[model samples]
Target: MPLKSTLAVPITDDPSLPVVTFRFWLISFFFTALGATVQQYYFFRSSSGTYSIFFVNLVSFSLGKAMARTLSERKFTLLGQTFSLNPGPFNIKEHALIGIAVSTGAGSAYAIDILSATDLFLGYRINALGSILLIITTQCCGYGMAGLLRRYLVYPAEMVWWSNLVQVVFYNTMHNTQDFQSIRLIRGWSRMKFFWIVTVTVFLYQFIPQWLAPILVYFDWLCWIRPFDMNFWAFFSSISGGGILSLSFDWTSIGGATMYLPLSAQLCSFAGVIVNYWIILPIMWMNNYMGVKAIGKPLTTKLFYEETGLPFNIKPFLNQDYSVNETLYEQGPPANMAPMYALGFMTSFMGLAACCTHVGFFHGREIWRNWKQAVGSDQEDIHTRMMRVYPEVPQLWYAGFYLVMAVLAAVACEFYVDLRYLLPGKPIANMTFKCYGYMAMSQCNLLLSDLKLGHYMKIPPRSMFVGQIWGTVVGCFFNYLTMILIINSQRDALDGTKPDANGLWTGQRVQTFWGSGLIYGALGPARMFALDGKYWFVYYGFLIGFLGPIVLWALSKKFPQYRWWSKLNVAIFAGGLHNFPNGYAMGILVSLITALVFQWFLFRYHKAWWTRYTFILSAALDAGAAFTGLIIFLFLGGGLSPKLAVNVPSWWGNYYTPEGDNGPYLAVDRCGAANNAWTSGAEL
Candidate 1:
């Protein structure tokens, strides 16, 4: 029996209901809003947004419910004919499973884009309106582009298995069955029980680390651990005494680093990380600090002059300071570093080369063959096959419509900001309007390229387009609005005690204005500067993200059954690249762990049960973590004032002071003297 069967509680479906009925909209709004809120909170608190994990759970649970109802409607259409797969009411379990599948695609893309935009533009601040706008624009663009490219990417038999979808299906089917229930024994529970347990565990873990840590979670303590120190000696001694050899378990240094990856890709990525962490960021930080210093101004002097009249202080560092120099060395404690530019250049070249070689070698011949087949050869092209699977929509029409919408969105943004004129004495140049149009175009191009890749793999184009569209629009519009609102609310937090030489808020608003301006001028470099001057780290991160997928692609080539590796690649890469402070590591670990457990159940016993139960378990865990995070932030953390505050002894209390009315907050005093100040001017 399918795992879903075991967990199958019954429900109903009503197709007669309007697509945008109040209930549907309400549910969508509530879940999306909750996700938006939590993501924004994390943005301000930790400077990283954990949207993927949060949304995965929300969409899974909600969609599961919706699927039950849809199944009850008992209507099926195939090849323009209505037929009953089952004689009576639709199987609630099957419908739920399908819902899980679709929801995974929808929610993952949604969360990814949301977090990406906030991380890139707003520093995770809570701007409800801005966030919404960002989300809507990005999602809309993504959808349109995906639709255009879907005919090529999704529909071929070769693309039957996307990694994330397969994982969802496999987990749900395998765990619910009786025969392979022992697989769940690894976690030591039935599907439902395991779900609850993991959910609680992860929730507690994420919250405690963020809220109750001895020091601010953002500080890089691990980087600052000196080898010759007494603390280090004690730590080593304790580990030795406890029979736990640090070297034995240190995965990074161990062969485990290369164990699962292709040698070339691994080496490139590892080298990239080294360069990012050790070199580029340090240079950027020194440059920025020295730039101000050279001008005979404190760093804070630049803050007040910023657009929002806030102080510069650490807020800019926390918000969007991802330059080559800022992202890497500037983030944590001072360390002996190395040159990064060379390493980054080398790795980037390697990655580009690898992508070219891999695609050319594996796909080039196929492309030619398909072209020949399309011209009336015996072999049919993938595109032709896909077209048979899903008839093409009028893509040109959609593209034109997208263009029109892009113009309107730009106009709306300009109108909102009242930037219709170029300068004090110039005619309305529409420069801002043109720039937005360019942004829309760029988004569309990215969507098209990704969709094309999907089409070649024979995945369903419609599904791929759907995911991208939702992601793009949600990311661009709603995401933007949310960020704006959040930033406004926490204006004080962002503006540290420094009066810019000109006496401005120099905090969040300055970063936002300058960062946006920089981004507009040069996307890659500007983003680097905005992120943290840690340009090398992001460069390295992108390489790492690309490598994981390449490895998975290679594995799939070697072992076709491991086609699921491709999906894993996307999940792991997305999880890691989109956040910082070892977010990628966390994503990789969690996904691999989940994959292992899921694989065991599917291979050893009932496949059906494994599919359903795995999804349920993942959803439950995600939901728990999200809600718990929300509660901790809103209540224990004094509603985001002191996210990392803790209540401890006076000695510890003296070591840290609460940012707001909350208890002692995380203090990394040694990191910088300016951190002690309440305003941006203190740094100046």
Candidate 2:
């Protein structure tokens, strides 16, 4: 096709390597559980905690390599099949499997949120078995859809899904080290040696944010400034979203992501974030557009209930009848959404319309043509051709995963929410879409990496499929159990409606999830689009959001001269719109800066330095971040109450939200109560 990059990635044509050995299984089983446990355990914490997949990859590879070096290949017969405890060597494929499993928890799953919501708020007791199955259905259902789209997403050479490029560079640099000639420009050791050295150093350095001075994770200079206006404070101080200074010290939060995203996508998303969250959100809320007063309640559900004159009384409303209580609903006015929430929703709506239009005009014909040539010669690509010797994973296999998830989903949807009345169909669908959106996206993106890795190492495509499929399936089991334990242990603290005793356990993310469920399920976004609705502008978001891409496309076609015009990706803007400045303002800024410096500049001119150091540096950050998160959970107040753990002193960093570990009292107004919360920080 086009000339390959100036940066060279040497590939291995060798096929014989140990993937599923005793060491592989041993490490996979243990870490998969550990990662899942670590993932869910931190859900109750005040910070936005998540395990890094880069961390997982590094750890898994190290373990796998150790096993290869130590354990001898002992061949044995089991049943009728001959097997070896250690096959040949620690291969990328097996390491990829472990990374795949850990990455399963890489996305925001709504099922876990559903578990927390019902248990914490609705008080619906879904037993352990039901809880386990519920996660499987919602999480696994997307794998099947991904399997079907494999040829489209995985086969195409140009479909070099940008995020995977980082992992690819790492995997190749480590596993195929012989090819990387040591250019004696400015290095001490080989790339592999340098990588390990950096990884170890950063791991040690992670303790700053891990257990000691957790406030180091976030920095906001303007947090000290106050006549104590909650609205003004929200713009600068709020860590969850909307800010001018978001210097997230946590590598997992911002550093690693900066190294992975493509330059174009990063630029587009950054522009969108500034336009929406920084500029328009303040202007709209300050002027009280459509009476939208939502700074005191940043997460928006409480504001919604108060605006509608119905503050959620779960017991009275969550009756035996699971149907929407129109009589109860009519007792108050219609629901009012927060500006940010409404914005995210409107962008989501826009995304739906824009994706259809963009895909139809751009890729519809190509896809349709490909579908017709199911097994035709057109299916060939350089990677696919190289992998042709390996057998293909039968579509039937993917279909099987799909069918199992569907049956479990149906039962889970029915029993998980209610027993006597059986939960309504809409909530089940809502949670499924919610979980599947992130699940499919994260997992499918993971699939792209696997394909590239497989191609590099000459792994059988079918074999790769088995590893990912089984890995995800196993991950769901532990993640669900972890959720169950966390929910049972801290019922009161995890409830967003109430305050945790020492702000140790805010369940902030789940609060958002629970609120999102209510919005999509009970008080749907459609109501906001109604003629007399308080959020009439939400409809305009969809209309405007839809038009943005159409205009760009029309311009690109009409002029055909400005080559860069077509590259203005609407998907990036739609994604950026859905997740605006508020949710990840500081993190986005960090990524933009990093991308601009390294990706935009170094990649363009100093290509050798860019290729040599970027991914290794990123991996170091991510590995350190993961270790930090795990240590925080194991040692610090990951789940323990403030009585048992050390709390960081109240400072500007922790003053953002009450859910933060060292946080001061939040800036929320009580439901139709006296407006005194903005004063004296948490009534202290």
Candidate 3:
């Protein structure tokens, strides 16, 4: 690895240590369930917090140690194998496996997004069996690719997959605590103790912004200045307008990735956000370009009717059979999205194109060389040398598992496709096709990263394979179950009947997915992006994204003195900008500040403190926010007690009558007039 100093991880191994034991299975399953529950539950929320592996690591450590101490190490035989209730002492390998399992299980399946989009927006539902098969297959289809590429991506020491190094360092930290000394930031407190303290503190504090006094989530001071002025509200209100200085204090709003991501990446994303939302959106709305002013806001993800400036009703555009009604579609105005939403799509287009070229220009040669060398070279790093003791997982095993999953996916997809025209479900076919095709590559990259983590930890390849499969299987079920529950209970919020008061249950993510289906499936790109169509200009994002990096690459080569040009990543910038339009306007400002503080200032100035506690701090914040948010949903938001729940005393902070609706004129800041300020050109 180029960053050899960071890779000074221990290379020693004790093969006698048990890789999989009774405790391993127990802790792995426990964490898989816990992680999945938390992740899937939060997946639909506006400020969807993650149940990160750092949180998993800490909890598993305590659980593993406790099991070792409490459980009798009595040996037992099962299916021709010997096992013990407790493993020899919760070694690093077992700890590493638990992390792997949780990481595999915690991600809400990508297929769930497709499923939820169809269920909520398109008003279609898959049978439970079909849903299960779809999720499992989509998740596992990437394993074969990962196995095939493992020689190039995993075994090679140079293919560092830099992000994995953080987790590897953390594994060593928690397991080998005595090697490091406690710092004065917390004064003699160890990393584990510090993590628990922060987690507990954040858990208690999250209630203020999450439940009680929710106005603080997006503390828009400027909106308070001219609360009733429609023009000012349009310009400054965080909820309905350009989110300038509007900052969210909640950790969930400011994602934990800020702690680790490079400052340059954050800055690039911020630049995109500034250009698209702050500048372009306002200009477009003012000029009424593409009838954007008719959409009622300069920046929102909601789809709108071009004529009425109201929510677009897909029912009108569809025939009785759910297929596009050519007569109605030709007669009605095309579906309109907010200007920012259009730009957001442009960002996605740019991101995809930029990603390919960026990789080619930057790392393509190195990767090609690595692939060639991986097949022939005998060279090895210390970690790779130590890892050789464990018998590698057979390629046939991965290929077999992948073939089975792919077959299952094809069958399920065929079943769905067969229902086209018989049901309003053509989108399901498109979504499934996209999911299996795209997710396999995405999942392969993820699996490769995890494999690298295993490589670093000297985990037995077979144990890694077994843990990944088990965890993925567990994740599929929990992800589906959680999606079903959320769609059932939060149907009103999800389907736009009754939006959540505190902005927690917006379903904007699935709404975005559904919007994509409308464009790609219902509307079709030919109609939406035609030369004379409204979004034709958006196709140019591809050109911009593709050529932008090549220009930067030339500039870097020409002016080597400007070292920063080489580091600038246009793809990251595009991806970051693409993410900002997902309902949290204040998140842009809050997350940028967080990145500067955690990744830039802290790392540059206080290296010691940053090294010891930064990742733990990030973990604690995510865990605390996740646990607190779940509790709010379960107990206060009617998960447990439907009738008695949500009985909070109404006040300015909790007054959540949506703007422009009947009940309340104001929504925490009396910005209702903003909704009426604009008129569709046809209406005008």
Q: What TM-score against the true fold does each predicted structure earn?
A: 0.53, 0.82, 0.92
Q: Which residues of candidate 3, in runs, are more than 4 Å off?
A: 1-6, 180-185, 316-322, 368-372, 376-388, 416-425, 640-644, 657-666, 674-684
Can you give the lDDT of residue 620 in candidate 1? 55
Residue-level lDDT tens digits of model 1 in 336-448: 11122223333444444445544554456766654443344454443444335543456875777578667655654454332334331111122233344555566555555
Give lDDT tens digits, candidate 2, residues 227-270.
25556555654343356554555555565656656788788877
Candidate 1: residue 483 Cα off by (Å): 2.3
Candidate 3 structure quality by residue, lDDT tens digits, 1-684: 256523456767788988777888888887787778778887887676778788888888888888889999778898998877875788888999888888888888988988897788768787888888889999998999999998777877666777777777777876787653444347678667778888899999999888887677767777666665544555566666776677777788886878877788778878877665566655765677766666655665667887777887776676654567767777867677776788887888899899888888877787777666666678865677788788988899998998898788777766753335312224455666678788899889888989988888888999999988989999889888878877877888788776665556778778777777776767777766788977777888899889989999899889989888846888887876775466556667778878888888889999887887787788989988988987887777766457546755766766754341323333443444523542222232
Shift of residue 404 alpha carbon in model 1, Å:
4.6
Query: What is the lDDT, from 0 to 100, of the residue 165 in candidate 1?
Result: 40
Better of 1 and 3 by TM-score: 3
What lDDT is reached at residue 529 by model 2? 57
**Ranking 1 against 3 by lDDT, winner:** 3
RMSD of 3: 3.1
What's the lDDT for candidate 3?
A: 0.76
lDDT, model 2, position 681: 32
Return the clash pairs for model 2, or none: 241-582, 242-582, 246-586
